[model samples]
Target: MTIIITGGAGFIGSNFIFYMMKKYPDYRIICLDKLTYAGNLSTLAPVMGKPNFRFVKMDICDREAVYGLFEEKNPDVVVNFAAESHVDRSILNPEIFLETNIIGTSVLMDACRKYGIGRYHQVSTDEVYGDLPL
Candidate 1:
Protein backbone atom coordinates (compact mmCIF):
# COMPACT_ATOMS: atom_id res chain seq x y z
CA MET A 1 0.00 0.00 0.00
CA THR A 2 1.03 3.60 -0.60
CA ILE A 3 0.36 6.44 1.84
CA ILE A 4 0.84 10.16 1.42
CA ILE A 5 1.49 11.98 4.70
CA THR A 6 1.17 15.74 4.53
CA GLY A 7 3.19 17.63 7.17
CA GLY A 8 5.24 14.49 7.72
CA ALA A 9 8.20 16.60 8.82
CA GLY A 10 6.36 18.18 11.74
CA PHE A 11 6.25 16.95 15.31
CA ILE A 12 3.25 14.62 15.44
CA GLY A 13 3.42 13.80 11.78
CA SER A 14 7.08 12.77 11.97
CA ASN A 15 6.37 10.39 14.79
CA PHE A 16 3.57 8.78 12.85
CA ILE A 17 5.86 8.36 9.84
CA PHE A 18 8.47 6.60 11.95
CA TYR A 19 5.93 4.29 13.50
CA MET A 20 4.29 3.39 10.21
CA MET A 21 7.60 2.90 8.41
CA LYS A 22 8.84 0.54 11.09
CA LYS A 23 5.62 -1.39 11.35
CA TYR A 24 5.06 -1.78 7.66
CA PRO A 25 8.36 -2.22 5.94
CA ASP A 26 6.80 -3.07 2.62
CA TYR A 27 4.47 -0.10 2.41
CA ARG A 28 5.43 2.96 0.37
CA ILE A 29 5.42 6.14 2.44
CA ILE A 30 5.43 9.48 0.66
CA CYS A 31 6.04 12.46 2.92
CA LEU A 32 4.85 15.86 1.72
CA ASP A 33 6.05 18.68 3.95
CA LYS A 34 6.32 22.42 3.35
CA LEU A 35 9.26 22.78 5.77
CA THR A 36 7.58 25.52 7.74
CA TYR A 37 8.74 26.90 11.09
CA ALA A 38 7.16 23.91 12.77
CA GLY A 39 8.54 21.37 10.36
CA ASN A 40 12.03 19.88 10.72
CA LEU A 41 13.41 17.67 7.98
CA SER A 42 16.14 16.30 10.24
CA THR A 43 13.50 14.53 12.28
CA LEU A 44 12.85 12.26 9.34
CA ALA A 45 16.52 11.52 8.68
CA PRO A 46 16.28 8.01 10.05
CA VAL A 47 14.02 6.84 7.27
CA MET A 48 15.45 9.02 4.53
CA GLY A 49 17.41 6.26 2.88
CA LYS A 50 14.74 3.62 3.14
CA PRO A 51 13.62 2.22 -0.19
CA ASN A 52 9.94 2.50 0.63
CA PHE A 53 10.13 6.10 1.81
CA ARG A 54 10.19 9.29 -0.29
CA PHE A 55 9.93 12.96 0.62
CA VAL A 56 8.41 15.84 -1.30
CA LYS A 57 8.64 19.47 -0.21
CA MET A 58 5.54 21.49 -1.04
CA ASP A 59 2.63 23.31 0.55
CA ILE A 60 -0.79 21.65 0.75
CA CYS A 61 -2.43 24.82 -0.48
CA ASP A 62 -0.69 24.58 -3.86
CA ARG A 63 -3.42 22.87 -5.82
CA GLU A 64 -1.50 22.32 -9.05
CA ALA A 65 1.51 20.83 -7.30
CA VAL A 66 -0.71 18.69 -5.07
CA TYR A 67 -2.66 17.43 -8.05
CA GLY A 68 0.54 16.57 -9.86
CA LEU A 69 1.84 14.61 -6.89
CA PHE A 70 -1.43 12.74 -6.50
CA GLU A 71 -1.34 11.81 -10.16
CA GLU A 72 2.23 10.58 -9.90
CA LYS A 73 1.85 8.65 -6.68
CA ASN A 74 -1.80 7.65 -6.74
CA PRO A 75 -1.57 7.00 -3.04
CA ASP A 76 -4.09 4.71 -1.43
CA VAL A 77 -4.21 6.73 1.78
CA VAL A 78 -3.74 10.42 2.53
CA VAL A 79 -3.02 11.59 6.07
CA ASN A 80 -3.36 15.37 6.38
CA PHE A 81 -1.44 16.96 9.22
CA ALA A 82 -0.47 20.22 7.54
CA ALA A 83 -1.30 23.45 9.38
CA GLU A 84 0.06 26.70 10.81
CA SER A 85 -0.06 25.57 14.43
CA HIS A 86 1.61 28.10 16.70
CA VAL A 87 -1.03 29.49 19.04
CA ASP A 88 0.87 32.70 19.81
CA ARG A 89 1.55 33.36 16.15
CA SER A 90 -2.01 32.48 15.26
CA ILE A 91 -3.29 35.02 17.80
CA LEU A 92 -1.11 37.66 16.18
CA ASN A 93 -1.92 36.76 12.57
CA PRO A 94 -5.06 34.72 12.26
CA GLU A 95 -5.24 35.02 8.49
CA ILE A 96 -2.27 32.73 7.94
CA PHE A 97 -3.81 30.18 10.22
CA LEU A 98 -7.08 30.34 8.33
CA GLU A 99 -5.31 30.04 5.01
CA THR A 100 -3.16 27.07 5.92
CA ASN A 101 -5.50 25.24 8.25
CA ILE A 102 -8.79 25.76 6.43
CA ILE A 103 -7.94 26.51 2.82
CA GLY A 104 -5.03 24.12 2.69
CA THR A 105 -7.21 21.31 4.00
CA SER A 106 -9.84 22.05 1.38
CA VAL A 107 -7.18 21.95 -1.31
CA LEU A 108 -5.96 18.58 -0.13
CA MET A 109 -9.46 17.12 -0.07
CA ASP A 110 -10.18 18.45 -3.52
CA ALA A 111 -7.05 16.74 -4.85
CA CYS A 112 -8.07 13.54 -3.16
CA ARG A 113 -11.46 13.70 -4.85
CA LYS A 114 -10.00 14.61 -8.21
CA TYR A 115 -7.21 12.02 -8.25
CA GLY A 116 -9.02 9.32 -6.24
CA ILE A 117 -7.85 8.16 -2.84
CA GLY A 118 -9.13 5.23 -0.85
CA ARG A 119 -8.88 7.01 2.50
CA TYR A 120 -8.14 10.49 3.80
CA HIS A 121 -7.38 11.07 7.47
CA GLN A 122 -7.10 14.49 9.03
CA VAL A 123 -4.90 14.89 12.09
CA SER A 124 -5.61 17.92 14.23
CA THR A 125 -4.08 19.16 17.46
CA ASP A 126 -6.06 19.56 20.67
CA GLU A 127 -5.86 23.34 20.23
CA VAL A 128 -8.81 23.08 17.87
CA TYR A 129 -10.99 22.64 20.96
CA GLY A 130 -10.14 26.18 22.09
CA ASP A 131 -8.71 27.26 25.43
CA LEU A 132 -10.81 27.22 28.57
CA PRO A 133 -10.40 29.59 31.50
CA LEU A 134 -8.29 28.20 34.29
Candidate 2:
Protein backbone atom coordinates (compact mmCIF):
# COMPACT_ATOMS: atom_id res chain seq x y z
CA MET A 1 0.00 0.00 0.00
CA THR A 2 1.11 3.58 -0.62
CA ILE A 3 1.51 5.94 2.33
CA ILE A 4 1.99 9.67 1.88
CA ILE A 5 4.08 11.25 4.60
CA THR A 6 3.97 15.04 4.56
CA GLY A 7 7.00 16.91 5.96
CA GLY A 8 8.87 13.62 5.77
CA ALA A 9 12.02 15.69 5.48
CA GLY A 10 11.66 16.99 9.00
CA PHE A 11 13.11 15.44 12.16
CA ILE A 12 10.31 13.34 13.58
CA GLY A 13 8.75 12.61 10.23
CA SER A 14 12.04 11.49 8.67
CA ASN A 15 12.79 9.22 11.59
CA PHE A 16 9.33 7.74 11.35
CA ILE A 17 9.97 6.98 7.69
CA PHE A 18 13.17 5.18 8.61
CA TYR A 19 11.32 3.16 11.17
CA MET A 20 8.55 2.24 8.79
CA MET A 21 11.03 1.33 6.08
CA LYS A 22 12.72 -1.10 8.37
CA LYS A 23 9.49 -2.47 9.74
CA TYR A 24 7.62 -2.85 6.48
CA PRO A 25 10.06 -3.17 3.63
CA ASP A 26 7.30 -4.31 1.30
CA TYR A 27 5.27 -1.10 1.52
CA ARG A 28 5.77 2.04 -0.58
CA ILE A 29 6.51 5.39 1.01
CA ILE A 30 5.72 8.73 -0.58
CA CYS A 31 7.36 11.65 1.17
CA LEU A 32 5.73 15.02 0.56
CA ASP A 33 7.72 17.92 1.90
CA LYS A 34 7.84 21.68 1.33
CA LEU A 35 11.46 21.91 2.54
CA THR A 36 10.66 24.65 5.01
CA TYR A 37 13.32 25.80 7.49
CA ALA A 38 12.68 22.86 9.79
CA GLY A 39 12.73 20.42 6.90
CA ASN A 40 16.14 19.26 5.72
CA LEU A 41 16.34 17.02 2.65
CA SER A 42 19.70 15.78 3.87
CA THR A 43 17.91 13.90 6.61
CA LEU A 44 16.26 11.67 4.00
CA ALA A 45 19.24 11.49 1.63
CA PRO A 46 20.06 7.95 2.67
CA VAL A 47 16.79 6.63 1.27
CA MET A 48 16.15 9.10 -1.54
CA GLY A 49 15.65 6.65 -4.41
CA LYS A 50 14.84 3.26 -3.06
CA PRO A 51 12.36 1.31 -5.13
CA ASN A 52 9.74 1.75 -2.42
CA PHE A 53 10.51 5.35 -1.49
CA ARG A 54 9.66 8.56 -3.34
CA PHE A 55 9.83 12.26 -2.58
CA VAL A 56 7.74 15.22 -3.74
CA LYS A 57 8.30 18.86 -2.88
CA MET A 58 5.10 20.83 -2.43
CA ASP A 59 3.48 23.13 0.08
CA ILE A 60 0.45 21.77 1.92
CA CYS A 61 -1.21 25.15 1.79
CA ASP A 62 -1.29 25.07 -2.00
CA ARG A 63 -4.73 23.63 -2.76
CA GLU A 64 -4.16 22.86 -6.42
CA ALA A 65 -0.83 21.21 -5.89
CA VAL A 66 -2.09 19.24 -2.91
CA TYR A 67 -5.12 18.05 -4.83
CA GLY A 68 -3.04 17.30 -7.88
CA LEU A 69 -0.70 15.15 -5.86
CA PHE A 70 -3.60 13.29 -4.31
CA GLU A 71 -4.98 12.58 -7.77
CA GLU A 72 -1.66 11.58 -9.24
CA LYS A 73 -0.23 9.56 -6.39
CA ASN A 74 -3.49 8.12 -5.09
CA PRO A 75 -1.94 7.41 -1.73
CA ASP A 76 -3.76 5.01 0.55
CA VAL A 77 -2.74 6.90 3.68
CA VAL A 78 -1.69 10.44 4.58
CA VAL A 79 0.43 11.53 7.52
CA ASN A 80 0.57 15.32 7.82
CA PHE A 81 3.76 16.54 9.42
CA ALA A 82 3.91 19.91 7.67
CA ALA A 83 3.72 22.76 10.16
CA GLU A 84 5.62 25.64 11.82
CA SER A 85 7.06 23.36 14.50
CA HIS A 86 9.26 25.68 16.47
CA VAL A 87 7.62 27.75 19.13
CA ASP A 88 10.51 30.23 19.18
CA ARG A 89 10.15 30.77 15.46
CA SER A 90 6.42 31.11 15.88
CA ILE A 91 6.99 33.77 18.55
CA LEU A 92 9.12 35.79 16.17
CA ASN A 93 6.75 35.46 13.20
CA PRO A 94 3.34 34.40 14.35
CA GLU A 95 1.93 34.90 10.89
CA ILE A 96 4.10 32.17 9.46
CA PHE A 97 2.99 29.81 12.20
CA LEU A 98 -0.63 30.73 11.78
CA GLU A 99 -0.46 30.30 8.04
CA THR A 100 1.49 27.08 8.07
CA ASN A 101 0.27 25.41 11.25
CA ILE A 102 -3.39 26.42 11.26
CA ILE A 103 -4.29 27.31 7.70
CA GLY A 104 -2.10 24.72 6.06
CA THR A 105 -3.49 21.96 8.27
CA SER A 106 -7.00 23.09 7.41
CA VAL A 107 -6.24 22.84 3.73
CA LEU A 108 -4.75 19.39 4.05
CA MET A 109 -7.64 18.17 6.16
CA ASP A 110 -10.12 19.50 3.67
CA ALA A 111 -8.34 17.73 0.83
CA CYS A 112 -8.24 14.49 2.79
CA ARG A 113 -11.92 14.71 3.60
CA LYS A 114 -12.85 15.45 0.00
CA TYR A 115 -10.71 12.65 -1.43
CA GLY A 116 -12.01 9.91 0.86
CA ILE A 117 -8.49 9.06 1.90
CA GLY A 118 -8.08 5.88 3.94
CA ARG A 119 -6.13 7.40 6.79
CA TYR A 120 -4.97 10.87 7.97
CA HIS A 121 -2.31 11.39 10.61
CA GLN A 122 -1.55 14.79 12.10
CA VAL A 123 1.83 15.51 13.66
CA SER A 124 1.47 17.93 16.52
CA THR A 125 3.86 19.46 19.05
CA ASP A 126 3.93 19.09 22.80
CA GLU A 127 4.80 22.79 22.95
CA VAL A 128 1.11 23.46 22.58
CA TYR A 129 0.69 21.84 25.99
CA GLY A 130 2.78 24.70 27.44
CA ASP A 131 6.46 24.98 28.31
CA LEU A 132 8.09 22.63 30.79
CA PRO A 133 9.11 24.08 34.11
CA LEU A 134 12.82 24.69 34.34
Candidate 3:
Protein backbone atom coordinates (compact mmCIF):
# COMPACT_ATOMS: atom_id res chain seq x y z
CA MET A 1 0.00 0.00 0.00
CA THR A 2 1.10 3.54 -0.78
CA ILE A 3 0.91 5.99 2.13
CA ILE A 4 1.30 9.74 1.81
CA ILE A 5 2.56 11.53 4.90
CA THR A 6 2.65 15.33 4.96
CA GLY A 7 5.23 17.16 7.08
CA GLY A 8 7.05 13.88 7.30
CA ALA A 9 10.33 15.62 7.89
CA GLY A 10 9.21 17.22 11.16
CA PHE A 11 9.70 15.90 14.67
CA ILE A 12 6.76 13.64 15.30
CA GLY A 13 6.22 12.96 11.63
CA SER A 14 9.81 11.86 11.13
CA ASN A 15 9.68 9.50 14.10
CA PHE A 16 6.44 8.06 12.83
CA ILE A 17 7.92 7.44 9.42
CA PHE A 18 10.88 5.71 10.98
CA TYR A 19 8.60 3.47 12.93
CA MET A 20 6.44 2.66 9.94
CA MET A 21 9.36 1.92 7.68
CA LYS A 22 11.03 -0.24 10.30
CA LYS A 23 7.88 -2.15 11.09
CA TYR A 24 6.50 -2.60 7.60
CA PRO A 25 9.02 -2.94 4.85
CA ASP A 26 6.37 -3.87 2.33
CA TYR A 27 4.54 -0.57 2.39
CA ARG A 28 5.40 2.41 0.21
CA ILE A 29 5.68 5.75 2.00
CA ILE A 30 5.58 9.13 0.31
CA CYS A 31 6.49 12.30 2.16
CA LEU A 32 5.05 15.72 1.29
CA ASP A 33 6.66 18.65 3.04
CA LYS A 34 6.91 22.38 2.37
CA LEU A 35 10.44 22.47 3.83
CA THR A 36 9.46 25.12 6.36
CA TYR A 37 11.72 25.88 9.30
CA ALA A 38 10.55 22.78 11.14
CA GLY A 39 10.65 20.49 8.15
CA ASN A 40 14.14 19.30 7.33
CA LEU A 41 15.32 16.70 4.86
CA SER A 42 18.17 15.94 7.21
CA THR A 43 15.69 14.45 9.63
CA LEU A 44 14.78 11.88 7.01
CA ALA A 45 18.21 11.43 5.49
CA PRO A 46 18.54 7.96 6.93
CA VAL A 47 15.65 6.70 4.85
CA MET A 48 16.08 8.64 1.63
CA GLY A 49 17.28 5.93 -0.73
CA LYS A 50 14.91 3.21 0.44
CA PRO A 51 13.00 1.75 -2.48
CA ASN A 52 9.64 2.43 -0.89
CA PHE A 53 10.26 6.00 0.19
CA ARG A 54 9.69 9.17 -1.86
CA PHE A 55 9.70 12.85 -0.97
CA VAL A 56 7.90 15.83 -2.46
CA LYS A 57 8.55 19.39 -1.40
CA MET A 58 5.29 21.29 -1.70
CA ASP A 59 2.91 23.35 0.40
CA ILE A 60 -0.29 21.66 1.44
CA CYS A 61 -2.23 24.89 0.95
CA ASP A 62 -1.47 24.81 -2.76
CA ARG A 63 -4.56 23.10 -4.18
CA GLU A 64 -3.36 22.61 -7.72
CA ALA A 65 -0.09 21.05 -6.70
CA VAL A 66 -1.71 18.89 -4.07
CA TYR A 67 -4.29 17.57 -6.51
CA GLY A 68 -1.61 16.98 -9.06
CA LEU A 69 0.40 14.97 -6.57
CA PHE A 70 -2.61 12.88 -5.68
CA GLU A 71 -3.17 12.20 -9.35
CA GLU A 72 0.43 11.29 -9.93
CA LYS A 73 1.08 9.26 -6.78
CA ASN A 74 -2.33 7.62 -6.36
CA PRO A 75 -1.60 7.10 -2.72
CA ASP A 76 -3.81 4.56 -1.00
CA VAL A 77 -3.61 6.28 2.39
CA VAL A 78 -2.93 9.83 3.58
CA VAL A 79 -1.62 11.23 6.83
CA ASN A 80 -1.80 15.00 7.40
CA PHE A 81 0.94 16.37 9.63
CA ALA A 82 1.58 19.69 7.88
CA ALA A 83 0.95 22.41 10.45
CA GLU A 84 2.64 25.21 12.36
CA SER A 85 3.14 23.11 15.47
CA HIS A 86 4.87 25.59 17.73
CA VAL A 87 2.50 27.21 20.23
CA ASP A 88 4.88 30.10 20.97
CA ARG A 89 5.03 30.96 17.30
CA SER A 90 1.28 30.65 16.97
CA ILE A 91 0.81 33.11 19.83
CA LEU A 92 2.99 35.60 18.00
CA ASN A 93 1.50 35.04 14.52
CA PRO A 94 -1.73 33.09 14.39
CA GLU A 95 -2.32 33.67 10.68
CA ILE A 96 0.48 31.35 9.55
CA PHE A 97 -0.74 28.75 11.99
CA LEU A 98 -4.28 29.01 10.71
CA GLU A 99 -3.17 28.81 7.10
CA THR A 100 -1.04 25.76 7.74
CA ASN A 101 -3.30 23.95 10.17
CA ILE A 102 -6.81 24.84 9.03
CA ILE A 103 -6.58 25.91 5.40
CA GLY A 104 -3.82 23.49 4.47
CA THR A 105 -5.65 20.60 6.06
CA SER A 106 -8.84 21.41 4.16
CA VAL A 107 -7.06 21.50 0.84
CA LEU A 108 -5.29 18.21 1.48
CA MET A 109 -8.51 16.54 2.50
CA ASP A 110 -10.17 17.72 -0.69
CA ALA A 111 -7.37 16.21 -2.72
CA CYS A 112 -7.57 12.93 -0.81
CA ARG A 113 -11.29 12.75 -1.38
CA LYS A 114 -10.90 13.42 -5.06
CA TYR A 115 -8.32 10.66 -5.38
CA GLY A 116 -10.41 8.16 -3.38
CA ILE A 117 -7.76 7.63 -0.74
CA GLY A 118 -8.66 4.56 1.28
CA ARG A 119 -7.61 5.98 4.65
CA TYR A 120 -6.73 9.38 6.13
CA HIS A 121 -4.92 10.31 9.32
CA GLN A 122 -4.11 13.61 11.02
CA VAL A 123 -1.26 14.24 13.43
CA SER A 124 -2.43 17.16 15.58
CA THR A 125 -0.74 18.97 18.41
CA ASP A 126 -1.73 18.49 22.01
CA GLU A 127 -1.55 22.27 22.41
CA VAL A 128 -4.97 22.41 20.76
CA TYR A 129 -6.30 20.61 23.85
CA GLY A 130 -4.87 23.23 26.20
CA ASP A 131 -2.15 22.70 28.83
CA LEU A 132 -2.73 20.17 31.58
CA PRO A 133 -1.72 20.57 35.19
CA LEU A 134 1.05 18.31 36.34
- Residue-level lDDT tens digits of model 1 in 1-134: 99999999998999999999989989999999999898999999999999999999998889899999999999999999988877899889988887778888889899989987869998865343355778
Residue-wise lDDT of candidate 2 within 93-119, one digit each (tens)? Answer: 878876777777888888888888978
lDDT of 1 at 42: 98
lDDT of 3 by residue, 1-134 (tens): 88999999999899999999999999999999999999999999999999999999999999999999899989999998887877789899989887888888889889878889878887766543345789
How does each model score on lDDT? 0.90, 0.85, 0.89
lDDT over C-alpha atoms for residue 22 of model 3: 96
Decreasing lDDT order of the candidates: 1, 3, 2
How many steric clashes between backbone atoms does each model show? 0, 0, 0
* Superior by lDDT: candidate 1 or candidate 3: 1
* Alpha-carbon shift of residue 5 in model 1 (angstroms): 0.3
Candidate 2 regions with alpha-carbon error over 4 angstroms: 126-134
Worst 10 residues of 2 by lDDT: 124-133
